[model samples]
Target chain A: MNNWFKILLLSGLSFFTLGKAQEKVTIGEKQNVFSKVLNENREIWIHLPKTYNDKEINPAKYPVIYLLDGEINFEYYTGLSDFIARTPYADIPECIVVGIKNTERTRDLTPTKSQKKSPVNPEVTLFADSGGGENFVKFLQEELKPFINKNYRTQDYSILVGHSFGGLFAINTFLMHPDYFNAYVANDPSLWWDNEVSITRTKEYLEKNKKFPAHKMLYVSQADNEEKQKNWNSDMTQAIEKFKGIVEKNGSLNYKHTFFPGEVHGTVSYPGNYEALKFIFKGFRTDIKQLAKNPGLLEEDYKQFSKKMGTEFFPSESYLNIVLKFMKSNDFKEPETYFMNLKNKLYPKVK
Target chain B: MNNWFKILLLSGLSFFTLGKAQEKVTIGEKQNVFSKVLNENREIWIHLPKTYNDKEINPAKYPVIYLLDGEINFEYYTGLSDFIARTPYADIPECIVVGIKNTERTRDLTPTKSQKKSPVNPEVTLFADSGGGENFVKFLQEELKPFINKNYRTQDYSILVGHSFGGLFAINTFLMHPDYFNAYVANDPSLWWDNEVSITRTKEYLEKNKKFPAHKMLYVSQADNEEKQKNWNSDMTQAIEKFKGIVEKNGSLNYKHTFFPGEVHGTVSYPGNYEALKFIFKGFRTDIKQLAKNPGLLEEDYKQFSKKMGTEFFPSESYLNIVLKFMKSNDFKEPETYFMNLKNKLYPKVK
Candidate 1:
């Protein structure tokens, strides 16, 4: 390490002559909606998918997912969603994500007030102003959903996502307001509040209702370590497990339960979120090879999906564009005429 | 859905007047370093860690990790690293990441040119210009490393990270230019390239050398389904498995291997990069409770790291600031006096 050489290394570095792509970075834009129900101004972070941005004209409208804990988990959820949408396997259709930020963590997310001790420590009591969940639900329905529906290009299909205390909020929303969203994803929710009052509510709901809505889905993940490894009893994991068994036994709702064996409560969210996304969109992948193999199968698949969704799923132009792309890249000859014929049939309505 | 209510949701759909902490999102800065070795300009994306921006004066110098495949994976790596560094359980020390963008990805990343067909399809041959990996390593050593080391507050302790062909590039650089980086992280490297040429080379090198340097660490991850579930034998996972077994058997070098089940090749990079970071920095998290238990332990831990890094890792001021923060947050009474005594001992050097 010669001093002069090190100094030379330190200075006069040359730059590129070629024009560089402009450095562009965006998480999402901040959106604030005044809530007449909660009587406060609320904030949300909204991220539209890349595919939506790709076509300036005739852009596709996407389903929306409302996420809780926006201030902390917004970046992670958006990043993961964007990645999943772009990837080939389990190709998630682009979805608009509205990440709702917290005004008060304990005040809003919890379904009930509790003077009970923290599950981990009996000495430390849970937050005092803890029963604002019903009001929060009112705010989302009356203020945010209507605003998003009026402003954005949306299919009116929706999902709700949350973690920890936020997860508790998600389950409460699902139980009380079932028609609000098509799916709910909860990760390691703190169900131990007020001696597992939320869990008890869940049990009562399951026992009363013979069947949940057929189209709606619920995904709940309990972290492996919190109860067993961290303590013996009375934790979030235990309450979640109890709720899971009851919900699973009811067998009426389209429910998924993921138990992450090696992951703890802290690290569980990342994998939990990823796994939950996969579970929610179980068949949401496009196999190019499989599509190329049988053109008729692709047509039938979308028809079946359309019937299930109660919306016409004639995605002719985009499907044609993809077919052309594959034809160029993979030298696929048969799919070109298949898409062209499909497009002709689909375009008559547009014409 | 009343017309007047819809108009209200739209009209009052304004942003928050409530003071937001400001949504801050940074991908990285665009950097172009002219490579005299390759006679071309190379572009890179560099993300400085949280600690770098924490202070205006006496900014902290971090160990840099140079990541290959910047254009695609840069955002993922930076996002994940930022998340891990901030989290409580796996509190990775602030690290500067330099993501190297590709001009000709196949040309630069592959060590040997392949005339053979794609592993999946024997009809279609692999890329023609693929033997430039040695020259690419030269460009990194002579040009990019010097530029990053010169411009940034870097400790000269470096890590090289890559995935797919980029992962192959990382392993080749490790085998050939071992002294260039302190650590290497490869995620499902395409070691199947040139009929497992890199794998053969890795095996040869291990056989020749009795022991690798103690300071260097290597982390390799392979997606579970690629070789076994997707196809058999002649896949990326097989080469990686072969290499992993050999490296782990030698047991002289610091090494880690992660097998991600049910994850395909395309998506493994996200969790793989995350798992690799956790493995590389095992027991790297800072626990306030652990620190409170023994006041002398933090000093000793940094001392050990410093010795291992061959540079003084007494992260003095930042470490102190965090300790003060924890003491305030957790109401630790003893660490206050502990910090005062430690400051008296360490601050004279700073003064």
Candidate 2:
């Protein structure tokens, strides 16, 4: 072969080698476009899982978890989600966690502006330009949703999780547009904002809106509060009680609230987010009673359930045992028999 | 002054300024020497907390969590521990985590060697050099422990956590020397090593050794074995059941076992470690039921108990709430009344 021909062949071989090398998951930066109600050039941080490219038979689609305060909480949430989703009891499906970067948190989160600076950081402006939450919601609904839907094989269900100001935004969004998300987690929301204006608003909204959708909401509070001495805890308690009381009066609204008494505002988000995720997507009935009745259903049947459920079901042996426990609880004659049945249905030749 | 003296003075000032600039938590390689047991030549990675240099009257001794696989898991664990500890639960005290580097995992982890190759990696030789677990434990007990104790203002309580082969080593150490650590978290231990030799050894140890100390042990496993079609699930379940049964029989042993059903052995460690830490150091509680009936005990009496308990007692508002839960469960009439009596005895101002 001529020199040029040889060079082309070599280059081709190099390209193939490089492609193979890049096959494994690369942990770094990726540019994402955001064109909601806001401006055009909004970039997002996307962390692709380890097995993003290698498998060829069937492409995997991840459940999307939209987190607010992308800049500050991205690494944390991503690391945590990556860690916990891979665990046993809280085996949430592997997800594409889209950390929505914050440009103006106050403007986007706050329903109404209160002329109050954060007590902790007096110099730092809290709400320079407030009451842009409606516009922000529009951005998420119109632009962001369409973009994500068009690009990724996203399931119908999505989770919105946030902290403090971001927490308020999540709650407000859930209240205003219930259909947008399947689950909502609010960590230590600024309930003290505008003398509980949002709480009052929540009460009014619940009263007017009779049809509450089937979903999950987790409210978390930290122990170290600046306003604790001045009844911040009682104020938050009263607000939550009032909200819960109203929901009770209406006799609807799927939600749970937890107080992280020993946790501070800054640190409560991680564990709260973790527990919230676990609570929301708590898997299908693995209880013994349900399984024992359907004795023929084998391991393969559950495996199929996992596959069908997609990213919502994090596959785990412990989870299977949990199902086994449920089965045994219902006086299932043989745990091994059920397992064998599952195995035969799922993979007859193997094992 | 002379011309040379003037130049030297200016140079000294410049050097001082340079020193100030470079003083902020210097990263990279450093040789740490603890005592005669540890060689000074060993490279150490030290991270001082944000408040390390703060000027405070009563500088607190931070709790330390020593981790295996320093090179890989250190940064992640350190960041996580710091973040969570700073949160509201204050479940475990804010700990300074120390990651111990490994030279050879197989050599360090294994207590005995068998001439066998890994089924997955038959081409590569396995278990060639093993039985270094004893020495590895000694290194921690003698060299590392003394050095850390001498250098840092560390609390008496310490945690030992490891994963994979390292996890096997951690369990081995815990089994051998329970007094060395307050808590032990082993994630995805290699139970299938040498045809379940470790499992056999554990069974033998439990049967023979009747006396078990008071410490926490958390073992975690994952779901990847099913994909490999190995008996990974059975192995995990058996180990868990056996361990739990042994602990239950002993009554003196405090242990918990969790299986991450779908999680791969490689990825289950992180979440398992976090959860294990939380589970282990839940809190310090004393049986106050006996004192409850004595109505004559003044509020000042409770203050004495608080004073005696010192750092172990709940100081933060949220922790107080948890204490209240404990109190209520023990049939205490009112948390305020109970706490008031305790506080007056232990802490006058707070009561």
lDDT for each candidate structure: 0.73, 0.57
Give the lDDT of residue B57 in candidate 2.
Answer: 19
Local lDDT at B50 for model 2: 36
Q: Find the 10 residues in a row with the least total lDDT in model 2 chain B.
A: B16-25
Candidate 2 structure quality by residue, lDDT tens digits, B157-266: 67888887777777778777877886777787765555666667666776787666533444443435454434334565455456556656767655666665545555
lDDT of 1 by residue, B188-260 (tens): 8888777788878877887788677777888887886543346432377778888887788888988888888
Question: How high is the TM-score of chain A in each model?
Answer: 0.86, 0.69
> Which candidate has the highest DockQ of all?
1
Cα error, residue B87 of model 1, in Å, equals 4.6
After superposing candidate 2 on the true structure, give the runs of residues whose Cα lies further than 4 Å from its correct spot: A1-36, A39-43, A87-90, A117-128, A150-153, A215-233, A248-251, A284-351, B1-79, B85-132, B135-159, B163-168, B174-272, B275-351
Candidate closest to the true structure, highest lDDT? 1
Model 2, C-alpha of B248: deviation from truth (Å):
13
Q: How high is the lDDT of residue B59 in model 1?
A: 62
